[model samples]
Target: MTTTTQYPECCAKDNGDALGMNATATSPISVDGTPVAGELYTIPPRCGRAVKLKKGQVIKIINTPGSQVCDTWFFNSDDLSEFASMEHTRAFIDKIIPQPGDVLVTNQRRAIVTLLTDTSPGVHDTMIAACDLFRYSNMGITEYHDSCADNMRMALNAIGLRAREVPQPLNLWMNTPVNPDYTISWLPTVSAPGDYVEIRAERDCVAVMSACPQDIVPINGCSPKEIQFTVAG
Candidate 1:
């Protein structure tokens, strides 16, 4: 398993703010990085982890196991009606071809988070499900370490949010390959320890994430690892 350390500092801002400061918190919450055995965290094949944040507080989820997927979603606490609609955001952000630097707009038409950094530079499907025992068995993957619902669930419980609806999640560090029939294959990740994708909060949005517990295939492999959520100054 890989350990995540040596977090780089973010001293710049892109929201047209003059400070251009990093979204470090005054009292940042640090949760123990624990790995669940057979849970995929939230969704059967997808889940959402949680973390409280300020409008400009920058949150970074470091992938310790490197290639493991950190599936996530962000919602508004004010009304909860306005949230990250994946299809809408995808269409609004990228009408034709989705690229970096596009803003993930919320249902209220607010800018949630700008696609700041994409380290993988490969395919990460928002359409894939989190791992689960049922799907694992159905897919003929029955070694018993397989799970897609591990981390995202834990995050929601830890942060005191009730499970409402499972929306489309952003798959972080997961590798997907497009075949001839337009089917995407989940391949191993292209990252190692210390390599991560960072996004600054465009608004004070609540984020849910799962450090994927998928063991069905070698994507996350058998040994699941830890990650870091640092709000630095």
Candidate 2:
């Protein structure tokens, strides 16, 4: 577990502005000094973990081997009804690709997570939902298989929560781009090894994250792999 004595004056300046700014304009994040002595959770491929976060604490998700995506869900620790929602987040930020300074919102239009610094390309998906058995079944693979939805459920259960309360997650590193013709392409991510995205908790929130296990698509390149999670105060 890492600890930080100070944070930036603000995450982003244009909080109320609907027009999103270029992520390149944001100040470079300097978290390399955060001690790595904190809790380090290594989430296996096709699996998930549910963890509680305190306000002002930072969570770092690392793509150890690169080109992998982490499916993430956030909920208020006090009220599960208010949770991370891609639709609500997009509506609040007015951007498809969340940047370093963006504040991730919940279905209740409340702040949940603030993306402090993204070391990767900032090309994440806000339109896709977590993969599930039903999704695989619809693709002609009726067999029971590992899925993010199931992983999330199991993780949440560990924290005394139900699967039904899970919401559409913030797809970190999954690159699905909307083209000019109103079409979208699901391409493999371009993140390199050691790439990471650090986020701050807006309020006390419980989070569930899954290393996606969809082997059918090129999303994971071939199969799912392990990811690292570091929590800093």
Candidate 3:
């Protein structure tokens, strides 16, 4: 029997409040000066939202104020099994040496999400997973709102994936300090305002992302910032 549990994946149009944030519309972009606001969108933090995008439409996820890790995931709308796997992502995408425009393809060599832009340019850590309340207090944070954990669980359950399998989240605005020996230190914000990463999914993908509600972690340790989304029809 295919057992399904009540999980936290129904984050469609949440107005973010936990992180002192909100999502507003930015000026629409144009294809050769003809605005395609119907096809593209910019997703903000603390809330998880999904936009149905078609072929050739580009979606941009910006670290609005910069240096905030936007936790993201994507699943094949038809087959969630061949989903976004960090281990498969790292192993196949030359994790030992990732760079700009590098396609983090699936085991089938199909494009998942492209690295259109990266601000904190260096060894990006795909191994370090997303941490939550249970792990936070143990890491010295006594009290923190369970935002990251909530959104992650939501994304997993939304697509029929199990919450326990929530894997390493792709840190869109995080920068890690690399020692001479390649040891990583989850460093502070290296991203400035308006730094964005663009992606055009090759196949129909049900994508989910969270503006991490991690006040305890240094990724957004100082505070949570806002994010914006402008969708093209």
- Using lDDT as the measure, which candidate wins? 2
For every candidate in turn, the CA RMSD to the true structure comes to 13.7, 14.4, 8.4
Candidate scoring better on TM-score of 1 and 2: 2
Best by TM-score: 2
lDDT (Cα, tens digit) per residue for candidate 3, span 1-233: 23332233333444221221123111112211232464444444565544444545556776777766776666665665555666677777766435677766654557776665555443345666665544555655544344554565544444344333454566666666567998877667776777766676667665556777666547776576665544332
lDDT of each: 0.54, 0.74, 0.55
lDDT of 2: 0.74
Query: lDDT tens digits, residues 1-233, model 1?
Result: 33322223222432111111111111113352232322222222223346655676666666655666776677775654566766777678654223467677776678887666665554456556655444555666434432334344444445454334445577777777678999867677777766665666777667766566665566666445555555421
Across 18-105, the per-residue lDDT of candidate 2 in tens digits comes to: 1112211121111211224376767777777777888988999999878788999888887877888899889899998889899989
TM-score for each predicted model, relative to the true structure? 0.68, 0.82, 0.69
- Hey, what RMSD does candidate 2 come out at? 14.4
RMSD of 3: 8.4
Better of 1 and 2 by lDDT: 2
User: Which runs of model 2 end up more than 4 angstroms from their true locations?
Assistant: 1-37
Candidate 1 Cα errors over 4 Å, as ranges? 1-49, 95-99, 132-134, 140-150
Question: To one decimal, what is the Cα RMSD in angstroms of model 1 from the true structure?
Answer: 13.7
